[model samples]
Target: MQSPTKPLAYSYIRMSTDIQLKGDSLRRQQQSSKAYADQNGLELAEAFKLEDIGVSAFKGANVSSGALGQFLALIKAGEIARGSYLLVESLDRISRQQVLDSIPVFFDIIKSGINVVTLADKHLYRAGETNFADIMYSVMVLGRAYEESKTKSMRVGAAWENKRKNAGTRKLTKVCPAWLSLQENRTGFDLIPERAEVVRQIFQLADTGNGSFSIARRLNQTAIPTFTKSNGWHESYVTKILNSRAVLGEFQPHRYDDHGDRVPYGEPVADYFPKIIEDDQFHRVQASRRRRLVEGAGRKGPEYRNLFTKIAKCEYCGAPMRFVHKGRPPKGSQALKCTNAVRGLGCESISWRYSDFETSFLYFVKEIDLTATLKAAAERSERATVEQQITVIEEKIRQLTAKRERIFELLTEPGSSTAFIKGKLDECEAAIATEGAQITKLREQRSMADMLPTISADELRSLIASVQDMSAPDIFERRAAVANRLSILVTSLRIAADGRRPKMKGIRTFLESQELNPDERDRLIDHIEKTNKQSQRYNRSFNVMLADGVSRYVVVKSDDPTDIIAEVLVDRDGAISGSDRGMPIGWSDGWDNVFDEPVSV
Candidate 1:
C-alpha cells in the first residue's frame, strides 16, 4: 500500500528511410527508449508501439497520414492520460522540418499535458514548463536537422538529373522492367524472350476486346508464372503492363516535389528501352480500352450472349435494356426487357425475343453496303483536325524548349544564383513534358481514327450464314465475335414498345388538392390501374442507328411472328434504300407518326 505505481510511458519511433530499418536504427531507438523508461521508474506501455518506418519528417508526412498523426489525434481527444510520457530517440526523430514549422509541433505535444523525453540528450520536456533556453535548444537542433535533409535532397536530385541527361550513354539504374535485365556492365538492358512474348500476348488479347481481368484469369488458368513473387497473375499487374509506355522504347524521368510525390521532371526520351509492342498496335489497344470504358463493357461473361451490350436502350425511358433468360433450356428463350420496367419504375414491361431480333438484324444489315458505309463513316476531316492539334502542341513544345535553353545559358553568367536557375529549368521542363504528352495523345487519336472494323462484307455474310442455326454449339462464340465487330459499326439500338405511359399525374395532383373522400380516391385509382394493364400488352420495336447516321426500324409483333416489319429510316441525305421493299406510307414523315396513337399504360 505504501509503494506508488509508476507513471505510464509510450515510445514513438520513426525513420526517414527504409534502409535504416535494415540497419540498427530500429533496435537502437527501441533499446534507448526502454532504458530511459527503466531508469525513470516509468511503466513503459506496450499497447501503443507507434512507428513511422520509411516516412519523411522533412515534408511532415510522418505527422500527416502516418502512425504519429494517429497518436497525436488520440492525445488531443483525451484518450491518453494527461501525465503520460512520450519517449523518442532525439529531437530530430520527432521532426526534421524547419525550426519555425517544427517548434509549434513540439510545443503542441507539451501543451497537451504530455512530457516529451529525448533519450539521446537525457532531457525531459515536462508539461506546463516554458523554459526559454529549452525552446531555443530544440529550435537549434531542428534547424540543423532541416539543413542536413535539404542538402541531402539537393545532392540526390542533382545525381538523378545527371543520370537522366546521360541516359542514352548508360543505364540509369539496375532496375529495369520485368521483361528486361540490366547488363553486367550496367551500360544497357536486354529483354528476356519468354517474358517479352508474354507481354506481347497480353497486348494482343487486350486489342481483341478482352478486359485485364479476363487476360489475367486466362494466363493463370494456363499456369503462366508471374514476373513478380506471386502465385499467379493479377488484373492490376496486367493493367500496369498495358498502361506502360516503357514498352514503346521510351523513358520518362521523374522527380519528387516538396510534398514527397513523384512528378514528371523532363520530356520523354525515345528509344531508352527495347521496343516490345509496335506503336500502331499499342495505340489500337488504348483505343479499345477507351471504347470499353465509354460502353461500360469492361466485364463480360464467356458466352457474350448479347450483341447489344451497352448499345441497347429503352426509347420510352432511356434506360438500358437488359438481356435475360426466360424459363428452362428447351422451353426457355432469351429475351431483352427494359431495365426500368423490370424494376417496376413506371415503364412498359414488354419483352423482345433475342433470337428473332438477332435474325432480323443479320438479314436486314446485309442489305446495306457495309464497306461503303464504313469508308464514308471514317471522316478524313477528323484526322485533319487531330493533325492541326498536334501542330499546335509541337509549337508549344518548341517555345518551352527554347525557354529552358535560355535558362541554361543564364546559369553560365557571373554571380547568378544556381538554385534560382535550377528552379526555373524545372518549371520549363515540366511544361515541355506536359506539351509532349498532349502531342502523344493527339497522335494516338489519329491512329485510332485509322482503326476500322477488320471484318469484310463477304466475311460477315459467310459468318451470318454459318450462325443461321440458333442451336449450333459454337453459336454463342460466333455471335460474340460478330457483336464485337458490330460494336465498331453500330452506334446505338433504341427499343420502343407499342404501349404509352398513362397521363394520370395531373388527375392525382388535382384529387389530392380537393381533399376527396376515400371512396372517390379508390374509384379513381382503380380506373388508372385498368388503363395501365391494357397498355402493357403491345408489340415491341427497335431503332438501330449506324455510325454514318443511317437508321433502321424493326417492328416485332408478339402475337404474329410473320408480321415482322424492317424498314430503314430516311438517311441524313434524305435517301432510304436498305430494304428491297419500299418504305410504308406516312413512315417517311418520321418516328412520331409510327407511335402517334398513344395507348394507355
Candidate 2:
C-alpha cells in the first residue's frame, strides 16, 4: 500500500570502522536507501543525508554523540518538516544499544513529527503514534541487535582462546619479541644478535645480584641503546624484561576487557618463542630477583635491609650511593661511594665519609625546637581549607571542560542541524563561563593563602628534635635508623659533593600539628614511610682503643655506614694506628677489597 503523495525522506547510514571503507559497504548502503526512496515515490532530502562511519552502535555512541544526536538537533530546530520520512538500511543500522536505551531514542524521533522507515522491512511508524505494535516491534528489533553484538563478542573471545591453544603447538606466524626475528622458513624465531646480547647482559647483571634500578643505571652509563625511542632503558622496562617468561622461551597469552585490564585467556606455552637466555641462567636470575626484591608484607631479602642503602643517591649521575669500608678489623676507614662511579662507569660523583656526614646531620638535628614547628604546622592546616576549596573548583572546571568537548563533538556531527547546534553551543558556552569564573575566584583565594608566614626557626628546631628522638638508641646499630626517620619527614635531602650537609625539602605539615611527644603515633607514621622506602641497613659499628696497656674505648667515625665493625688503636701521641703491630706499616685491607663479595644487610 503506497502513499499517493510521497513525503521527503532523510537517509541515515552507519558503519563501525573505517576499515569497512575498503569494501563497498558505504556504496551498498547508499544504493539501497536511494532505490527505496525511488520505489516508494518519496523525495530524498539531499542536505539531510547523515552517515556515521567508524562508530559503534553497541556502545550507544549512535544516540549519544553521533549522527543521531545531530538528527535530533535538526528536528528540534524544525529544519526537517513534519511528516518527513527517516530512512535507514535496517533497524539495527540505527542502533544496537540495549532495548531500554534504544527504544527511548526511537520514541523521541517519532515524537518529533517525523516518520521512521526501515527500507529492508518496509516498516513505517509515524510521529505521535502510540500503538503497542510499533513499540513491541521496535523493542524486538533493537533487542536482537544488542544480543547479536554480545554474541559476536563471545565468539571473538572463544576464537582468541582457540588461536592461543594453536599457538602452543605451532610457532607464531607474525609478531615476535624484540630480541627475536623469524627464521628463513618463517617457521621459528632466531636471535637478533645485538638485541639478543642486550638481553643476555640484562640476565647476566641480574644473575650477579644487581637489582633492576642498578641495571638500568649501568645500561645508561654504558651508552647502550634501547628497542624503543620513547622510554630508553627505564627501570620499569628492566623489571618487565626480568619478569617476563619470554626470556626462557615461553609465550604467555592474555585477553583484555573493555577497560584494558588483562585476563588469563590460556595456559602459557613453553618453547613457543626462541630462548634468549639459558634456562638455568634465567631461573638463577629469577632466584636472585626474588632474594633482592621485597613486596609489602611478603618475602624480603637481606640485600635491601639497610636504612640508607638506596636513599642516598649520587648527585652526579643520580645513581645510588653505597658505603665503602676501607681496611680490615682494628684499622677503621669508610666512605659513602657511588657504586657506578667506583666501577669507572663514567660517573664523576665523589664519595663522603660516614662520620663527617652523620656529625653534621646530628648537629643540625640538635638545634631544632619542636614547639614552634607545631604552631607553624597549625597555621598550615588553616591554609589547607582554602586549598581544599580551590581543588574542588578546579575539578569542577575539568569536568565542565570534558562535557563541553562532548557537546562540541555532537554539534559537529554530520547530521547536526544548524539550529540545534546553535542552542547546544550556547548552553555549553554559558556553563563553561560560569565554571571559569568559579575557578578564577578560587585561584585568587589560593594566592592569598600562599602569602602566609613561612616556617619559623623554632619550628625547624622542633622538627629536628622530633626526628632525633625517633632514632634508634643503638648508635652502633647497622641501621642508620635516625637518618631514615628524618628522611620520612622531608620530601628529599640533597647532599652536595664537597658540602656534605643535606638540604631538605617539603617538611611534612602534619608533624607540626601533632601533640608534643606524640610517641607511638609519630613512630607509626615513620614506620609506614620506612616500609614504603625500605633502605638497606649498613654496618655502623667501629672501635678504637687507646695504648699504654690500659684499653680505652673509642669510636672511630668514618663516612662509610656499612655494619662491619672496623677496630683501630690510638697511640699516646693521639695518632690513629692499625693493630698490625708485627706487619709492615702500610699492611692493611684496602677499600677495593670490601666489595669483592656481595654486601648483604
In terms of lDDT, the best-performing candidate is 1
lDDT of 1 by residue, 10-123 (tens): 999987766788999899988888888899899998777799887789878888787878888999999988999999988888888878888888899999999999888899
| lDDT tens per residue, model 2, 82-134 | 99989887888888877888878888889989999887777888788998998
Best model per TM-score? 1
Task: Name model 1 segments beyond 4 Å from true.
Answer: 2-5, 73-80, 130-133, 217-232, 252-270, 278-284, 298-305, 309-356, 361-601
Worst 10 residues of 1 by lDDT: 592-601
Q: What lDDT does each candidate get?
A: 0.73, 0.60
Cα misplacement distance, residue 64 of candidate 1 (Å): 4.1
Clashes of 2: 24
